[model samples]
Target: MTAPRTGDQRLAGRTALVTGGGSGLGAVLTHALADTGARVVAVGRDEAALERTAAARPGAVLARQCDVSDPDSVAQLAGSLADEHIDILVNNAGVPGPVAPLTEVEPQDWDDVFAVNVRGVYLMCRTFAPGMTARSDGDILNIASVSGKRPLAGRTPYCASKAAVLGLTTTLAAELGPQGVRVNSLSPGPVDSARMRRNFTMEAERTGVTYEEAERRFVSRALLERMVTEEEVAEAAVAMIGLTGLCAADLDLSAGMVAR
Candidate 1:
């Protein structure tokens, strides 16, 4: 999935850090951000994957391995990058929790999801917001999901965690707006990626439906009747970062999912 080129260096000279930047949509975002002439730090738990992502953009994108769910790891990451002021932070690290009913979900599984999806964002913001506040400039984009606004049966943990992210983004925007730091979130619908494929496969098995049928049912809710592409989400992230006045906004790149 190739992101459309803008031929514009809007974010030139900016330093951006993207969590979960090793693979999937995160990798796409890292590339997109680098294309805008921003030096990007791609952080994730997988060293090999992060290396591959950084290899694509060479010097423009640096790969770092850090588990966002760990406080010490996040602190260490912040310490390592202390010399460079991060102008943009994309909290894209998240996990799709168990695809089962609430009763079938284990407490630990729920905690694990929150650890990455919710706590991870909190930790990143807590660590980095102060620098932005002191400088009086920065952009924080939290990748959320449409499942938070609508219903995704049997995905309580994932849904709840994303909903929390929306709340966090808005409140933080208010808290930090006066200080000149912009906080916002991008909520994309079921993106066409390996993650969603796994989700559809699980849903099919759980509901006794064919994989195609399960996927169809999920996309049917969107007015576009299709899953959003990774490129679309990445493009939206770049656009949000460039939009200076856009703060406390939950940009729904969900193919009209919320409308439906």
Candidate 2:
């Protein structure tokens, strides 16, 4: 076969599975992966949202509904796709827990956060990593947050879960690297997503400031003084997947939150 043109898609001939592919950064990542010429399977608990993502990409994306935190669900999805060779897996499903001091946070609230952020990544890797061993070459990108590296006050649960994700990524990298599976975590600080906008609104109300002001203050803390965009995070994800030598490392896109 002739070599692809330089302008051709970078991820041509690859197949990708993105968890949390329904909304926010997840949806954007799905679009970005498909644009790179990969056949992407957008998996999430929200079937409608997954379908919407797929509709936007048409044939490039296949929408599948599966809750990454649910063992049976993950297993079922993995079983169905057992025969397919998956080149990339993005564990992006996550939840931002309530903003409050750890002392006041409910036990259940903490568990809920861990269920989605930590347990979700674990289940996905448990189900999919074995199959990837056959190929001995694939990418596993866990969508962690900078808060995991640098603790964020008033978000103990989120901070803790993401920290666990970072640890999980490191350990998994060691366990899977010899098999040729590159495992890493992509930790983005604060992205200008719809969910983040609502979070800004909450801060605005609580701090008695305008939404714009709250958002401005939020981004001002970053070295770039701006919120990272979803597309930027997707670009980082693409870059992480393209690298074969890098594993068990974190690709931070927090604009400098962790740096500070």
CA lDDT of each candidate? 0.94, 0.87
What does candidate 2 score on TM? 0.93
The candidate that wins on TM-score is 1
Pick by lDDT: which candidate is best? 1
Q: Lowest lDDT 10-mer window, candidate 2?
A: 3-12
Give the C-alpha miss distance for residue 182 in model 1, angstroms: 0.5
Among all windows of ten consecutive residues in candidate 1, which has the lowest summed lDDT? 2-11
* lDDT, candidate 2, at 20: 92
The digit string of per-residue lDDT tens for model 1 on 177-241 reads: 99999999999998999999999999999999999999999999999998899999999999988
Candidate 1 runs further than 4 Å off: 1-8
